[model samples]
Target: CSTFLHKLQRKSNRKRSVVSSGELHRNRRYAINPLGHKWDHHNLTYRIVAFPNTLNRDDTRKALSIAFTKWSDVSPLTFTEVTANATADITIGFYTFNHTDCWWSPLHPCFDGLNGELAHAFLPPRGEIHFDNHEFWILGKSRFSWAQGVWLNDLVQVAAHEIGHALGLWHSRDPQSLMHPNATYTGQRNVGQDDVWGIRRLYAADKKRVCDPWASTSASANDEILHEKNCPLRCDLPLESELPPRHVPRWLKWSLRCGHKNLRTTQNRYKTSPRASRAEGL
Candidate 1:
């Protein structure tokens, strides 16, 4: 769940989007979509509907595989790639600015080339993830060369962040959690305690309740989520909680435009503080 404001500054006007990537806070817990979106089953399948030219297929698969494991390691959720004729539960692709029709359902914002709005993904059931093809995606923890003009964005890190969205996780208030929206493009990240709490709670609640996925969506307080009041009934309920969080207001996008700076020395690169932009869709 990172945002164009992630430059994800989430790039969408739809209410279902959860564009991410900004902000940090003390050790806190994670958050779920207020509307309540999540998989009912622990075993899940995903497929690469599209792959980026910037990365080799083998490397891309390798990276994404590791990223999915980050979640499975902390929860009962298991992810398997579906390459055969069968349709997968989740799909991933990369697109540039205005590649998809904005008027259509599940709408999202156009990519802005380099900085803001890095990537966005849909919450559960829709299972779609999109990335900006324009960025310089790379493998490894985090390293960039001013001379080579390569401001490498880590595929593993960003994919992991977006995967959280597909899993129905919103941005975590915890700065170190992999679900944190800000400072994503800068380096490698792992699942933190806050994230574990979120994922576990989501599925745990899922098993204990009865939901009606087709129930017409309605509105109430944010606390209504995860309370097991209705076990998040209504296939598409009143809330379609999200992450990667496209589908936010346009004005918020401007505020989400944050960047890093002044890494003048390679030795001190790790010490560079990322811009503290507001975490979108939090």
Candidate 2:
């Protein structure tokens, strides 16, 4: 029993260390890493296979739809929802514990239960986003008022972040960017300029007409169109002074650590091995 307890303590400490390292890496610079691949085509379809019990079907759909819109509005790519089809370029769903990353499963890096990690996504062609169903997901603005015990992760904000991953973006060091691994819960929904620039780097924008009346007389229509389309939305990167200060609530960190303790206790009862413990219905 002492050996078992020691092992569990080591594992818990390791997990906490990883969390700390990830937090540090997420606040460094603009681009931390890249998926190294992107979709060949611009148009993409997504399907929501499962919904969380925390939010109704309509609310879940709305939150996800808004997330998709947030990306499409800034980028040249387009996303269409496929309700009838089970397969799509992107598959979004909610799973608890080790449902997606079981020993026998092909996928990996599963949810770490209620807290610790909220959600994750596969990059580019894989296009899979999985949310920890155990989370207290705040779907709409009004829903947060009724939230009680658990930390309420904003659905739209998380969705937008995950969607950025699905589109081939890596974790950004900018805390204000949507692609930041540890995105804050500030109730702001729009994707940051850094995120927009990242996606643009992956997929070139399709040709679109622009109205520019003040261009030099020598500049042809095609030249004006090229310049206007290349610099979509004015490319105003957020200055360091203008960026909001990183704000993580003290209670959130405490809640996650407490949740990890419960998870550790549950794992110990089943078995020390993650696969064996998961198989035994943890």
TM-scores, one per candidate: 0.62, 0.60
Off by over 4 Å in 1: 1-28, 102-107, 185-188, 205-282
Query: In terms of TM-score, how similar is model 1 to the real structure?
Result: 0.62
Residue 220, model 1, lDDT? 28
RMSD of each: 19.6, 21.9
Using TM-score as the measure, which candidate wins?
Answer: 1
The candidate that achieves the highest lDDT relative to the unseen native structure: 1
The pairs that clash in candidate 2 are: none
| Candidate 2: 10-residue stretch with minimal lDDT | 252-261
lDDT of 1 by residue, 110-196 (tens): 677776666788888888888888877777775676986866788888888889888988776567778876738434388876677
- 95 in model 2: Cα distance from truth in Å? 0.4
